[model samples]
Target: MNLALLFEDDFVSADRAVLTGRRLAHLNSVLKVSEGDLVPVGLVNGDIGTGLVVGLSDTEVVLQVELSEPPPSPLPLTLVLAMPRPKMFRRVLQTCASLGVKDIWLINAYKVEKSFWQTPWLSEENLRENKVLGLEQARDTLMPRVHIRKLFKPFVEDELPALLHNTRALVAHPGTDTPCPTHINEPATLCIGPEGGFTAYEVDKLVEAGCEAVHLGRRILRVETAVPVLVSRLFDACN
Candidate 1:
Protein backbone atom coordinates (compact mmCIF):
# COMPACT_ATOMS: atom_id res chain seq x y z
CA MET A 1 0.00 0.00 0.00
CA ASN A 2 1.36 3.45 -0.95
CA LEU A 3 -0.49 5.35 1.77
CA ALA A 4 -1.46 3.60 4.92
CA LEU A 5 -5.12 4.59 5.40
CA LEU A 6 -6.14 5.17 8.98
CA PHE A 7 -9.77 5.15 9.93
CA GLU A 8 -11.18 6.97 12.96
CA ASP A 9 -11.16 3.79 14.97
CA ASP A 10 -7.44 3.31 14.27
CA PHE A 11 -6.58 6.52 16.05
CA VAL A 12 -5.60 6.03 19.66
CA SER A 13 -5.21 9.75 20.25
CA ALA A 14 -5.32 13.00 18.33
CA ASP A 15 -1.95 12.44 16.71
CA ARG A 16 -1.32 8.73 16.90
CA ALA A 17 -2.64 5.81 14.87
CA VAL A 18 -2.29 2.05 15.20
CA LEU A 19 -2.35 -0.30 12.27
CA THR A 20 -2.64 -4.06 12.08
CA GLY A 21 -3.95 -6.78 9.78
CA ARG A 22 -3.26 -6.10 6.10
CA ARG A 23 -1.42 -2.84 6.66
CA LEU A 24 0.90 -4.26 9.26
CA ALA A 25 1.67 -7.16 7.01
CA HIS A 26 2.46 -4.87 4.13
CA LEU A 27 4.81 -2.84 6.30
CA ASN A 28 6.57 -5.92 7.55
CA SER A 29 6.90 -7.73 4.28
CA VAL A 30 6.96 -5.04 1.64
CA LEU A 31 8.41 -2.00 3.39
CA LYS A 32 10.34 -3.62 6.22
CA VAL A 33 10.20 -0.37 8.09
CA SER A 34 11.65 0.13 11.52
CA GLU A 35 11.11 2.32 14.54
CA GLY A 36 11.95 5.97 13.88
CA ASP A 37 11.31 5.52 10.16
CA LEU A 38 8.77 7.63 8.39
CA VAL A 39 6.01 6.37 6.15
CA PRO A 40 3.22 7.95 4.19
CA VAL A 41 -0.17 7.97 5.81
CA GLY A 42 -3.56 9.56 5.40
CA LEU A 43 -6.76 9.67 7.38
CA VAL A 44 -9.68 8.24 5.54
CA ASN A 45 -11.57 11.08 3.86
CA GLY A 46 -9.38 13.60 5.62
CA ASP A 47 -5.77 14.60 4.94
CA ILE A 48 -2.49 13.38 3.49
CA GLY A 49 0.73 13.46 5.47
CA THR A 50 3.50 11.41 7.05
CA GLY A 51 3.64 9.02 9.97
CA LEU A 52 6.70 8.52 12.12
CA VAL A 53 6.96 5.01 13.40
CA VAL A 54 7.20 5.15 17.15
CA GLY A 55 6.59 1.50 17.78
CA LEU A 56 6.55 -1.69 15.71
CA SER A 57 6.00 -5.35 16.38
CA ASP A 58 4.79 -8.58 14.84
CA THR A 59 1.19 -7.80 15.59
CA GLU A 60 0.86 -4.07 15.12
CA VAL A 61 2.55 -0.76 14.49
CA VAL A 62 2.07 2.61 16.14
CA LEU A 63 2.81 5.90 14.49
CA GLN A 64 2.82 9.54 15.35
CA VAL A 65 1.03 11.31 12.53
CA GLU A 66 0.77 14.86 11.34
CA LEU A 67 -2.01 15.47 8.90
CA SER A 68 -1.67 18.93 7.41
CA GLU A 69 -2.03 18.52 3.65
CA PRO A 70 -5.36 18.13 1.99
CA PRO A 71 -6.01 15.21 -0.30
CA PRO A 72 -5.89 15.56 -4.09
CA SER A 73 -8.80 17.32 -5.75
CA PRO A 74 -11.49 14.88 -6.70
CA LEU A 75 -12.57 14.58 -10.33
CA PRO A 76 -15.75 16.50 -10.94
CA LEU A 77 -17.09 13.50 -12.74
CA THR A 78 -19.78 11.01 -12.01
CA LEU A 79 -19.28 7.56 -13.61
CA VAL A 80 -22.36 5.54 -14.43
CA LEU A 81 -21.52 1.92 -15.20
CA ALA A 82 -23.52 -1.12 -16.02
CA MET A 83 -22.71 -3.79 -13.48
CA PRO A 84 -19.62 -5.70 -14.60
CA ARG A 85 -18.83 -9.36 -14.27
CA PRO A 86 -18.43 -10.18 -10.60
CA LYS A 87 -14.83 -11.28 -11.04
CA MET A 88 -13.72 -7.92 -12.40
CA PHE A 89 -15.94 -5.54 -10.44
CA ARG A 90 -13.48 -5.10 -7.57
CA ARG A 91 -10.73 -4.04 -9.96
CA VAL A 92 -13.12 -1.59 -11.61
CA LEU A 93 -13.92 0.00 -8.27
CA GLN A 94 -10.20 0.26 -7.52
CA THR A 95 -9.51 1.83 -10.91
CA CYS A 96 -12.24 4.41 -10.46
CA ALA A 97 -10.92 5.41 -7.05
CA SER A 98 -7.31 5.57 -8.23
CA LEU A 99 -8.35 7.93 -11.00
CA GLY A 100 -10.11 10.27 -8.54
CA VAL A 101 -13.66 9.50 -9.50
CA LYS A 102 -15.68 10.68 -6.53
CA ASP A 103 -19.14 9.62 -7.62
CA ILE A 104 -20.03 6.23 -9.14
CA TRP A 105 -23.37 4.77 -10.15
CA LEU A 106 -23.79 1.07 -10.87
CA ILE A 107 -26.90 0.13 -12.80
CA ASN A 108 -28.07 -3.03 -14.49
CA ALA A 109 -27.99 -3.52 -18.26
CA TYR A 110 -29.59 -6.14 -20.46
CA LYS A 111 -26.32 -8.07 -20.77
CA VAL A 112 -25.48 -7.82 -17.07
CA GLU A 113 -26.09 -11.04 -15.27
CA LYS A 114 -28.45 -10.86 -12.32
CA SER A 115 -25.97 -13.06 -10.48
CA PHE A 116 -23.32 -10.36 -10.74
CA TRP A 117 -25.09 -8.34 -8.04
CA GLN A 118 -24.98 -11.29 -5.71
CA THR A 119 -21.18 -11.21 -5.49
CA PRO A 120 -19.70 -10.56 -2.09
CA TRP A 121 -17.58 -7.80 -3.60
CA LEU A 122 -20.72 -5.67 -3.79
CA SER A 123 -21.21 -5.96 -0.06
CA GLU A 124 -20.74 -2.72 1.86
CA GLU A 125 -17.66 -3.98 3.65
CA ASN A 126 -16.00 -5.39 0.54
CA LEU A 127 -16.75 -2.28 -1.49
CA ARG A 128 -15.04 -0.14 1.11
CA GLU A 129 -12.13 -2.53 1.27
CA ASN A 130 -11.49 -2.42 -2.46
CA LYS A 131 -11.82 1.34 -2.53
CA VAL A 132 -9.30 1.54 0.28
CA LEU A 133 -6.85 -0.45 -1.79
CA GLY A 134 -7.39 1.97 -4.66
CA LEU A 135 -7.01 5.07 -2.51
CA GLU A 136 -3.83 3.78 -0.99
CA GLN A 137 -2.46 2.99 -4.42
CA ALA A 138 -3.11 6.58 -5.50
CA ARG A 139 -1.91 8.03 -2.16
CA ASP A 140 -5.28 9.71 -1.78
CA THR A 141 -7.56 10.06 1.19
CA LEU A 142 -10.91 11.29 -0.11
CA MET A 143 -13.23 8.31 -0.38
CA PRO A 144 -15.47 7.75 -3.36
CA ARG A 145 -19.20 7.19 -3.05
CA VAL A 146 -20.87 4.25 -4.83
CA HIS A 147 -24.54 4.27 -5.69
CA ILE A 148 -26.27 1.07 -6.73
CA ARG A 149 -29.30 1.10 -8.95
CA LYS A 150 -30.56 -2.32 -9.97
CA LEU A 151 -33.38 -0.98 -12.07
CA PHE A 152 -31.98 0.82 -15.09
CA LYS A 153 -35.17 2.22 -16.57
CA PRO A 154 -36.28 3.89 -13.35
CA PHE A 155 -32.84 5.30 -12.77
CA VAL A 156 -32.61 6.70 -16.31
CA GLU A 157 -36.15 8.07 -16.43
CA ASP A 158 -36.54 9.31 -12.88
CA GLU A 159 -33.08 10.29 -11.67
CA LEU A 160 -30.41 10.64 -14.39
CA PRO A 161 -31.72 13.97 -15.71
CA ALA A 162 -31.07 15.80 -12.45
CA LEU A 163 -27.71 14.07 -12.12
CA LEU A 164 -26.66 15.49 -15.49
CA HIS A 165 -27.57 19.07 -14.63
CA ASN A 166 -24.87 21.61 -15.58
CA THR A 167 -22.57 18.80 -16.62
CA ARG A 168 -21.35 17.34 -19.91
CA ALA A 169 -23.03 13.98 -19.96
CA LEU A 170 -21.93 11.27 -22.38
CA VAL A 171 -22.57 7.61 -22.81
CA ALA A 172 -19.65 5.64 -24.34
CA HIS A 173 -20.85 3.44 -27.16
CA PRO A 174 -18.56 1.54 -29.49
CA GLY A 175 -20.39 2.05 -32.78
CA THR A 176 -21.51 5.65 -32.32
CA ASP A 177 -20.85 8.49 -34.75
CA THR A 178 -19.57 11.08 -32.30
CA PRO A 179 -16.10 10.54 -30.84
CA CYS A 180 -15.53 11.05 -27.12
CA PRO A 181 -14.28 14.52 -26.24
CA THR A 182 -10.88 15.05 -24.63
CA HIS A 183 -9.66 16.99 -21.58
CA ILE A 184 -12.98 18.62 -20.79
CA ASN A 185 -12.98 21.21 -18.02
CA GLU A 186 -16.59 21.20 -16.92
CA PRO A 187 -18.20 18.63 -14.68
CA ALA A 188 -19.28 15.47 -16.47
CA THR A 189 -21.31 12.32 -16.05
CA LEU A 190 -20.24 9.34 -18.20
CA CYS A 191 -22.19 6.16 -18.72
CA ILE A 192 -20.48 2.93 -19.81
CA GLY A 193 -22.42 -0.19 -20.48
CA PRO A 194 -21.54 -3.86 -20.09
CA GLU A 195 -19.11 -5.54 -22.50
CA GLY A 196 -21.84 -6.29 -24.97
CA GLY A 197 -22.79 -2.61 -24.85
CA PHE A 198 -26.03 -1.01 -23.73
CA THR A 199 -29.14 -2.18 -25.46
CA ALA A 200 -30.60 0.29 -27.96
CA TYR A 201 -33.61 1.05 -25.78
CA GLU A 202 -31.38 1.80 -22.80
CA VAL A 203 -29.18 4.12 -24.85
CA ASP A 204 -32.32 5.87 -26.06
CA LYS A 205 -33.45 6.34 -22.48
CA LEU A 206 -30.05 7.76 -21.48
CA VAL A 207 -30.11 10.07 -24.50
CA GLU A 208 -33.58 11.20 -23.58
CA ALA A 209 -32.18 11.92 -20.13
CA GLY A 210 -29.49 14.24 -21.66
CA CYS A 211 -26.43 12.12 -22.42
CA GLU A 212 -24.85 12.35 -25.87
CA ALA A 213 -23.87 8.98 -27.22
CA VAL A 214 -20.16 8.91 -28.00
CA HIS A 215 -17.56 6.37 -29.11
CA LEU A 216 -14.01 5.47 -28.02
CA GLY A 217 -12.90 4.36 -31.49
CA ARG A 218 -13.74 0.96 -32.93
CA ARG A 219 -12.07 -1.12 -30.21
CA ILE A 220 -14.32 -2.80 -27.66
CA LEU A 221 -12.71 -2.31 -24.30
CA ARG A 222 -13.73 -4.10 -21.15
CA VAL A 223 -15.42 -2.11 -18.41
CA GLU A 224 -12.27 -2.13 -16.29
CA THR A 225 -10.09 -0.97 -19.18
CA ALA A 226 -12.50 1.69 -20.41
CA VAL A 227 -13.00 3.39 -17.03
CA PRO A 228 -9.48 4.76 -16.60
CA VAL A 229 -9.04 5.48 -20.33
CA LEU A 230 -12.21 7.52 -20.37
CA VAL A 231 -11.31 9.30 -17.15
CA SER A 232 -7.86 10.22 -18.46
CA ARG A 233 -9.26 11.37 -21.77
CA LEU A 234 -12.00 13.48 -20.22
CA PHE A 235 -9.92 15.20 -17.53
CA ASP A 236 -6.71 17.18 -17.84
CA ALA A 237 -5.26 15.87 -14.58
CA CYS A 238 -6.65 12.40 -14.08
CA ASN A 239 -5.05 11.70 -10.68
Candidate 2:
Protein backbone atom coordinates (compact mmCIF):
# COMPACT_ATOMS: atom_id res chain seq x y z
CA MET A 1 0.00 0.00 0.00
CA ASN A 2 1.36 3.40 -1.00
CA LEU A 3 -0.78 5.28 1.51
CA ALA A 4 -2.41 4.20 4.76
CA LEU A 5 -6.11 5.01 4.26
CA LEU A 6 -7.67 5.97 7.56
CA PHE A 7 -11.35 5.60 8.19
CA GLU A 8 -13.30 7.49 10.86
CA ASP A 9 -12.98 4.49 13.16
CA ASP A 10 -9.21 4.68 12.96
CA PHE A 11 -9.14 8.07 14.66
CA VAL A 12 -8.76 8.22 18.42
CA SER A 13 -8.74 12.00 18.46
CA ALA A 14 -8.65 14.88 16.01
CA ASP A 15 -4.99 14.39 15.23
CA ARG A 16 -4.36 10.81 16.35
CA ALA A 17 -5.21 7.57 14.56
CA VAL A 18 -4.54 3.87 14.99
CA LEU A 19 -3.73 1.22 12.44
CA THR A 20 -4.32 -2.53 12.58
CA GLY A 21 -4.99 -5.55 10.41
CA ARG A 22 -3.56 -5.39 6.87
CA ARG A 23 -2.17 -1.89 7.32
CA LEU A 24 -0.43 -2.87 10.53
CA ALA A 25 1.09 -5.88 8.79
CA HIS A 26 2.21 -3.66 5.93
CA LEU A 27 3.89 -1.31 8.37
CA ASN A 28 5.71 -4.10 10.22
CA SER A 29 6.65 -6.26 7.24
CA VAL A 30 6.61 -4.32 3.98
CA LEU A 31 7.58 -0.83 5.12
CA LYS A 32 9.57 -1.92 8.23
CA VAL A 33 8.56 1.33 9.85
CA SER A 34 9.00 2.06 13.55
CA GLU A 35 8.18 4.71 16.08
CA GLY A 36 9.27 8.20 15.00
CA ASP A 37 9.02 7.37 11.30
CA LEU A 38 6.69 9.33 9.08
CA VAL A 39 4.46 7.58 6.54
CA PRO A 40 2.06 8.77 3.90
CA VAL A 41 -1.51 8.72 5.15
CA GLY A 42 -4.94 10.01 4.23
CA LEU A 43 -8.47 10.02 5.56
CA VAL A 44 -11.12 8.44 3.41
CA ASN A 45 -13.05 11.03 1.36
CA GLY A 46 -10.73 13.60 2.93
CA ASP A 47 -7.30 15.13 2.51
CA ILE A 48 -3.86 13.65 1.83
CA GLY A 49 -1.02 14.08 4.27
CA THR A 50 1.58 12.36 6.44
CA GLY A 51 1.46 10.56 9.76
CA LEU A 52 4.18 10.36 12.34
CA VAL A 53 4.39 7.01 14.06
CA VAL A 54 4.30 7.99 17.73
CA GLY A 55 3.52 4.54 19.08
CA LEU A 56 4.12 1.08 17.64
CA SER A 57 3.78 -2.55 18.67
CA ASP A 58 2.86 -5.90 17.16
CA THR A 59 -0.82 -5.30 17.79
CA GLU A 60 -1.24 -1.73 16.51
CA VAL A 61 0.39 1.50 15.43
CA VAL A 62 -0.49 4.99 16.59
CA LEU A 63 -0.10 7.90 14.27
CA GLN A 64 -0.23 11.61 14.76
CA VAL A 65 -1.54 12.89 11.43
CA GLU A 66 -1.74 16.25 9.72
CA LEU A 67 -3.93 16.49 6.66
CA SER A 68 -3.61 19.55 4.43
CA GLU A 69 -3.42 18.53 0.79
CA PRO A 70 -6.44 17.65 -1.26
CA PRO A 71 -6.75 14.27 -2.92
CA PRO A 72 -6.34 13.89 -6.68
CA SER A 73 -9.02 15.46 -8.82
CA PRO A 74 -11.72 12.98 -9.78
CA LEU A 75 -12.29 12.11 -13.42
CA PRO A 76 -15.33 13.67 -15.04
CA LEU A 77 -16.20 10.31 -16.55
CA THR A 78 -19.05 8.00 -15.64
CA LEU A 79 -18.26 4.37 -16.44
CA VAL A 80 -21.16 2.14 -17.43
CA LEU A 81 -19.75 -1.34 -17.69
CA ALA A 82 -21.06 -4.85 -18.16
CA MET A 83 -20.21 -7.03 -15.18
CA PRO A 84 -16.90 -8.81 -15.80
CA ARG A 85 -15.87 -12.25 -14.57
CA PRO A 86 -15.42 -12.62 -10.83
CA LYS A 87 -11.68 -13.12 -11.11
CA MET A 88 -11.21 -9.79 -12.94
CA PHE A 89 -13.78 -7.66 -11.15
CA ARG A 90 -11.64 -6.83 -8.10
CA ARG A 91 -8.71 -5.72 -10.22
CA VAL A 92 -11.02 -3.63 -12.37
CA LEU A 93 -12.43 -1.89 -9.33
CA GLN A 94 -8.94 -1.14 -8.03
CA THR A 95 -7.83 0.14 -11.42
CA CYS A 96 -10.85 2.40 -11.75
CA ALA A 97 -10.24 3.91 -8.33
CA SER A 98 -6.55 4.41 -9.06
CA LEU A 99 -7.43 6.11 -12.35
CA GLY A 100 -9.71 8.54 -10.47
CA VAL A 101 -13.03 7.27 -11.79
CA LYS A 102 -15.50 8.34 -9.08
CA ASP A 103 -18.60 7.02 -10.79
CA ILE A 104 -19.03 3.40 -11.84
CA TRP A 105 -22.04 1.43 -13.01
CA LEU A 106 -21.95 -2.34 -13.28
CA ILE A 107 -24.82 -3.56 -15.39
CA ASN A 108 -25.70 -6.92 -16.84
CA ALA A 109 -25.23 -7.64 -20.54
CA TYR A 110 -26.52 -10.58 -22.56
CA LYS A 111 -23.11 -12.21 -22.47
CA VAL A 112 -22.60 -11.63 -18.73
CA GLU A 113 -23.11 -14.76 -16.66
CA LYS A 114 -25.59 -14.54 -13.81
CA SER A 115 -22.99 -16.29 -11.68
CA PHE A 116 -20.74 -13.25 -11.97
CA TRP A 117 -23.00 -11.22 -9.67
CA GLN A 118 -23.02 -13.95 -7.05
CA THR A 119 -19.33 -13.47 -6.33
CA PRO A 120 -18.42 -12.51 -2.77
CA TRP A 121 -16.38 -9.63 -4.13
CA LEU A 122 -19.62 -7.76 -4.74
CA SER A 123 -20.53 -7.78 -1.05
CA GLU A 124 -20.58 -4.40 0.71
CA GLU A 125 -17.63 -5.20 2.97
CA ASN A 126 -15.51 -6.71 0.20
CA LEU A 127 -16.35 -3.86 -2.17
CA ARG A 128 -15.10 -1.31 0.34
CA GLU A 129 -11.97 -3.34 1.00
CA ASN A 130 -11.06 -3.52 -2.71
CA LYS A 131 -11.75 0.18 -3.15
CA VAL A 132 -9.47 0.94 -0.21
CA LEU A 133 -6.67 -1.01 -1.87
CA GLY A 134 -7.17 1.03 -5.04
CA LEU A 135 -7.19 4.32 -3.17
CA GLU A 136 -4.01 3.41 -1.33
CA GLN A 137 -2.32 2.44 -4.59
CA ALA A 138 -3.09 5.84 -6.08
CA ARG A 139 -2.40 7.77 -2.85
CA ASP A 140 -5.94 9.04 -3.18
CA THR A 141 -8.57 9.29 -0.45
CA LEU A 142 -11.82 9.98 -2.29
CA MET A 143 -13.89 6.80 -2.54
CA PRO A 144 -15.49 5.78 -5.80
CA ARG A 145 -19.14 4.85 -5.81
CA VAL A 146 -20.16 1.55 -7.46
CA HIS A 147 -23.69 1.16 -8.66
CA ILE A 148 -25.03 -2.27 -9.57
CA ARG A 149 -27.86 -2.80 -12.02
CA LYS A 150 -28.70 -6.43 -12.71
CA LEU A 151 -31.38 -5.90 -15.37
CA PHE A 152 -30.07 -4.40 -18.60
CA LYS A 153 -33.17 -3.05 -20.35
CA PRO A 154 -34.68 -1.26 -17.40
CA PHE A 155 -31.37 0.42 -16.55
CA VAL A 156 -30.87 1.61 -20.13
CA GLU A 157 -34.43 2.82 -20.62
CA ASP A 158 -35.03 4.32 -17.20
CA GLU A 159 -31.73 5.41 -15.64
CA LEU A 160 -29.14 5.83 -18.41
CA PRO A 161 -30.77 8.82 -20.14
CA ALA A 162 -30.49 10.90 -16.99
CA LEU A 163 -26.89 9.79 -16.53
CA LEU A 164 -26.08 10.83 -20.11
CA HIS A 165 -27.21 14.39 -19.42
CA ASN A 166 -24.55 17.05 -20.05
CA THR A 167 -22.02 14.36 -20.90
CA ARG A 168 -20.74 12.85 -24.10
CA ALA A 169 -22.01 9.24 -24.20
CA LEU A 170 -20.15 6.48 -26.00
CA VAL A 171 -20.43 2.70 -26.02
CA ALA A 172 -17.30 0.73 -26.89
CA HIS A 173 -18.22 -1.97 -29.37
CA PRO A 174 -15.69 -4.13 -31.23
CA GLY A 175 -16.65 -3.55 -34.87
CA THR A 176 -18.20 -0.10 -34.75
CA ASP A 177 -17.22 2.32 -37.47
CA THR A 178 -16.39 5.24 -35.19
CA PRO A 179 -13.11 5.07 -33.29
CA CYS A 180 -13.24 5.89 -29.62
CA PRO A 181 -12.52 9.61 -29.37
CA THR A 182 -9.25 10.67 -27.75
CA HIS A 183 -8.21 13.32 -25.22
CA ILE A 184 -11.76 14.53 -24.73
CA ASN A 185 -11.99 17.45 -22.32
CA GLU A 186 -15.69 17.16 -21.77
CA PRO A 187 -17.40 14.80 -19.34
CA ALA A 188 -18.35 11.45 -20.87
CA THR A 189 -20.33 8.34 -20.02
CA LEU A 190 -18.65 5.23 -21.48
CA CYS A 191 -20.29 1.82 -21.74
CA ILE A 192 -18.20 -1.33 -22.13
CA GLY A 193 -19.44 -4.87 -22.61
CA PRO A 194 -18.66 -8.32 -21.21
CA GLU A 195 -15.99 -10.85 -22.37
CA GLY A 196 -17.74 -11.62 -25.68
CA GLY A 197 -19.00 -8.04 -26.06
CA PHE A 198 -22.58 -6.87 -25.85
CA THR A 199 -25.25 -8.56 -27.95
CA ALA A 200 -26.65 -6.64 -30.92
CA TYR A 201 -29.96 -5.96 -29.15
CA GLU A 202 -28.19 -4.77 -26.02
CA VAL A 203 -26.01 -2.39 -28.06
CA ASP A 204 -29.13 -1.02 -29.73
CA LYS A 205 -30.69 -0.22 -26.37
CA LEU A 206 -27.59 1.62 -25.17
CA VAL A 207 -27.34 3.52 -28.46
CA GLU A 208 -30.99 4.46 -28.20
CA ALA A 209 -30.29 5.79 -24.70
CA GLY A 210 -27.93 8.36 -26.31
CA CYS A 211 -24.56 6.56 -26.49
CA GLU A 212 -22.62 6.69 -29.73
CA ALA A 213 -21.25 3.27 -30.63
CA VAL A 214 -17.46 3.44 -30.91
CA HIS A 215 -14.59 0.96 -31.24
CA LEU A 216 -10.99 0.64 -30.09
CA GLY A 217 -9.58 -0.52 -33.41
CA ARG A 218 -10.01 -4.15 -34.52
CA ARG A 219 -8.52 -5.69 -31.38
CA ILE A 220 -11.00 -7.10 -28.91
CA LEU A 221 -9.74 -6.25 -25.43
CA ARG A 222 -10.97 -7.88 -22.27
CA VAL A 223 -13.08 -5.74 -19.92
CA GLU A 224 -10.17 -5.36 -17.46
CA THR A 225 -7.75 -4.20 -20.16
CA ALA A 226 -10.32 -2.12 -22.00
CA VAL A 227 -11.30 -0.01 -18.97
CA PRO A 228 -7.87 1.54 -18.35
CA VAL A 229 -7.17 1.80 -22.08
CA LEU A 230 -10.45 3.57 -22.77
CA VAL A 231 -10.08 5.87 -19.77
CA SER A 232 -6.56 6.85 -20.77
CA ARG A 233 -7.64 7.38 -24.39
CA LEU A 234 -10.60 9.55 -23.48
CA PHE A 235 -8.88 11.74 -20.89
CA ASP A 236 -5.64 13.55 -21.54
CA ALA A 237 -5.12 13.92 -17.80
CA CYS A 238 -4.70 10.15 -17.45
CA ASN A 239 -1.83 10.11 -19.95
Q: In model 1, what is the error at residue 174, expressed in angstroms?
A: 1.0
* lDDT (C-alpha) at residue 115 in model 1: 93
User: Candidate 1 lDDT, tens digit per residue, 23-97?
Assistant: 999999999999999999999999999999999999999999999899999999999999999889999999988
Candidate 2, residues 1-239, lDDT tens digits: the string is 99999999999999999999999999999999989999999999999999999999989999999999999899999999899999999999999999999999999988999899999999999999999999999999999999999999999999999999999999999998999999998999999999999999999999999999999998988889999999999996453
**What are the lDDT figures for the candidates, one per model?**
0.94, 0.95
Candidate 1: which pairs clash? none
Candidate 1 worst ten-residue window by lDDT? 230-239
Best model per lDDT? 2
Off by over 4 Å in 1: none
